[model samples]
Target: MTKTARQLQEEGLLYDVFEQELTDIKDRTYGLVSELSRASYFDTEYVMSLVRKIVAKIGQDSYIVPPFRCDYGDHVFIGNNTYINYNCCFLDSAKVTIGDYVYMGPNCNIFTPCHPIHHELRKEKVTEYALPVTVGSHSWIGGDVVITPGVTIGENCVIGAGSVVTKDIPDNSIAVGNPCKVIRQVNDKDREYINSLILDDETKNSKYKQEHGYVYSAKDEAIFNIVKDTVHYVEILNKLSNSEIQRRRDFLRTFVAKLDEGAMINSPFYMEFANHLEMGVNSFINYDCIMLNNAMVKLGDNVLVGPKVSFYTAMHPIDAKQREQWLVYAKPITVEDNVWIGGSATILGGVTIGKNAIVGAGAVVTKDVEPNTIVVGNPARVLRKITAEDSKKYQEELAKQKDINKSEFDKMMAGQWYNAMDYSMLKLRQENNKKTEAYSRITINTLSYKDRMAKAIVKEFGENANIIPPFTCDYGCNVKVGNNTVINHSGVFLDTNEINIGKHALIGPKSGLYGAIHPFDVEARNEGIEKAKTINIGDGAWLGGKVTVVPGVSIGKHSVIGAGSVVTKDIPDDVVAVGNPCRVIRKITEDDKINPIRKK
Candidate 1:
């Protein structure tokens, strides 16, 4: 008896994706998904009913946010108390099993189909395979994560944000990055951390001490009740449509201590103490902002707080014993008038930003920022003082930039389609090739000469950074390697555009980073139209032998890409990812630490 396409797929054999049976199932699933998407998010009972009709099994208290997509609804199984956030996609060609008490953040994707590598075979609708994906009980998957086919995430695991999970993750692990690896185990420290947030009665009385730079407990009954109420209020505010502006304002006025006239905060804002937050007139707080305002957090007039900015006024004791005792403290955070806090910046407790200050993206502010200055990087060092000349320079540049036509090179640099075979581009590539070829010709034994030639080949070559003599790149000038980075033998960096490698990186032998991307359309390809995207390898990343990173992919800090992996997307920091089409297996953890080997 011959097996059907569905049967073949389930049996881990190659099958056609466009089989009549699969297409019919998918069409049904799409109808249900469309219905689910159209339904109101507030209609909980109706939403759950639709979800039940869609999935194979939905345990008690399981909820899926609207706008969810999946190939076959019957192949998806979700356990009890599982809360899946918005815009999640599950390509359940095979079984997709999600365990109980699992929390999946927004925009998570799970793929169960593997298409043929050969484009001709794929075009012919042959050699597609499906595999199961399972998430164990009590696991948390962060936003924008992708879990590939045949992957099993063990119980009590924490998969961090923006991870591409391609392999099995072990139980009780905390993993993060592109190809996620275990960074640590879920242990007593985690439990203690949670416990330390809960305060006893005696510690609660020390609230006055918090204002005076002394330790206090925030777990007071009144505070807990306030936080709970705030959570409920925020949830409602977040759910409300943008059209209900007046209603949102009214709710905010009632919930927050002082929300001045003309001040606005975008939806999806989170706060522990809403009553402790004060916004001045005309101040604007962007989306996904978080304020743990145990103490007062005040933003002055005309302040611009970017998206994902966090103002933290809480602190725990440094000593483990003291921390375990639940001793915590709070200090006020103040943003003066005309301050601009960039996206993803964290403002720590007891910090003040002087007027007209600018905090750069991803900066960690620990101390006060000086007035009229631009601060950037970790620990928020002052990049430069704001000068009158700066305004003039930018204004003049803006005037000159208006309605200007960009060249092919400029378009290419901006990640737009361009003529790749232009004369200037060809000349640049030819010159780069000469330098690379010259560097390759030098012997490894001639250390000084080789090092000098290596520097001549690339732009911005950092101190102690080394690329073996046999390494190659299309445009050496587009490559910028940081201090202490090493590119092993036979490495290929097709740096059509910028390829920035962070410090302490290890690019294994035969590894390739391809920045160039040709158009998918045959006509565009024939016309020599192409574009290039930047590839970034973050600090301390290790790519094993024969790993291939495609255009626009960023391997995050301290990440490990396994051998023979092909990275197609961004990998977050601190993970171990492996497989063909690399995915995070687990995260790098403290347990992975080993003592330095001694000489025999």
Candidate 2:
């Protein structure tokens, strides 16, 4: 007969089991914590009440951000004025004691349970044991840091970003890196240096430099000049009139640190500092991509980046107050040769995407991706290695495209589509759409408000460029509709990836332009992951009512899509495409343009 949980705990046994029959207290408590994790980040009192119910003891004035979790909260203890950041997880299978004035950064994990290594020992009626984890008072744990079981972090410690602590740490030390080690002790000399850096400001009674220790005077000549030049480039692209391809390319190349021969960046790209941004030969950067390069970001030769992809090298303090003070740091990001990053993928700081790796769309990559591997979903996991089967399809479909190399990672980079539904992505879209939905409710009849709404998407609305109200998008900032473009009412333009509409383009009412899509597999779809591709509608293009254009599609210059057509494939220039899976019906001729006639 199986022993009761209390009896098993008294004997020190395993508990992270899936099929085990937990008691009502455990069931309800775990369920309650799940609900609390889904609660609003702003609901401090409510979440704190729930936190108190779960933890063994929590001290006064200690605040934990919502969406925190533990296996058994009853084994956890927290001290006074301790603050935990977003999405922190603790496995309180054994005791977890966090002392006073502690700071925990976002995405930090403190696990106290170890699984059995022996296969036979994991069978029914198996025994288990867990080690405890402790963090002494007045310490700071950086983002993405992980502390393993049986680790006791000392008081007044500073654990650096991405550090993994597997052993005990002494007090008043700075610990960092995988298998963390102390670098130095905090001393008064550090305080003296910090005091000297502080700037004085006038107040009624006294002068003070800052509200937090993290704040410092941020000044960089390179970054300052880069920002100004980049802004000017964006303005030029938004109002670009002449279609001199070479001139356009030349203008765009000046925005980045390096743009090799045959490299192409679809217009309306965004970056914090262009000086640190470098692109190798024949690399393809699709529309509406955002690169926050506080540190160097380099993409190797033949790299293909899909739409709305983002690389962030900037990060802030774990302490909320410190973040408010705008104290920040950054790490560089590098993409090796022949890599392809799908649309809507977000690569985090200090991550190096290996050569020929394919990062699936909508993946929130927090770690380095291995070379020649395909990774998908939140905290992206490797799906499989690039095989011959994948390469065969690549040769068949996009053979005509230049720089379509068969390097290990680039073959069919966009072929594998998986579903990844993330909480953070969902939350962001929800917040963004809320604002767009409000704009949708505004009176479409008014020209001024309509113009104001159009400004949300287009930087410079050209001669008669306008959008009828009832518009919806993930973010308006990525889109730039060109001159004489008329987007009809109730248009759902999913601008998660950049949507570029050229001059004289006519979009019928209720047409949906989707730049990103989720995995089709039921399980993957449930994961809320996505793959994005840019949708480009060239000049003189026309779309009928209720047309839907899927991701990574391009409607060629002066092409026409019939009513209610679903465009899954790219249509060539000056063609008439129509159908559920829209196909070309006929080519546009001079006879068809001046006067209407049936092609016989």
Candidate 1 vs. true structure, TM-score: 0.48
**Model 1 clashing-pair count:** 16
TM-score of each: 0.48, 0.43
The deviation in Å at residue 192 for candidate 2 is 3.5
Per-candidate clashes, comma-separated: 16, 10
By summed lDDT, the worst window of 10 consecutive residues in model 2 runs over: 204-213
User: What value of lDDT does candidate 1 attain over all alpha carbons?
Assistant: 0.70
lDDT of 1 by residue, 73-173 (tens): 89899998787866577878789999987878654678776543222333334345777999988787865466877899998788765456868999888
Give the poorly placed runs of model 2, Cα more than 4 Å off.
Answer: 1-3, 14-23, 125-127, 203-600
Where is model 1 more than 4 Å wrong at Cα? 1-5, 12-23, 34-44, 61-69, 81-87, 115-128, 202-393, 399-600
Note each model's CA RMSD in angstroms.
Answer: 17.8, 21.5
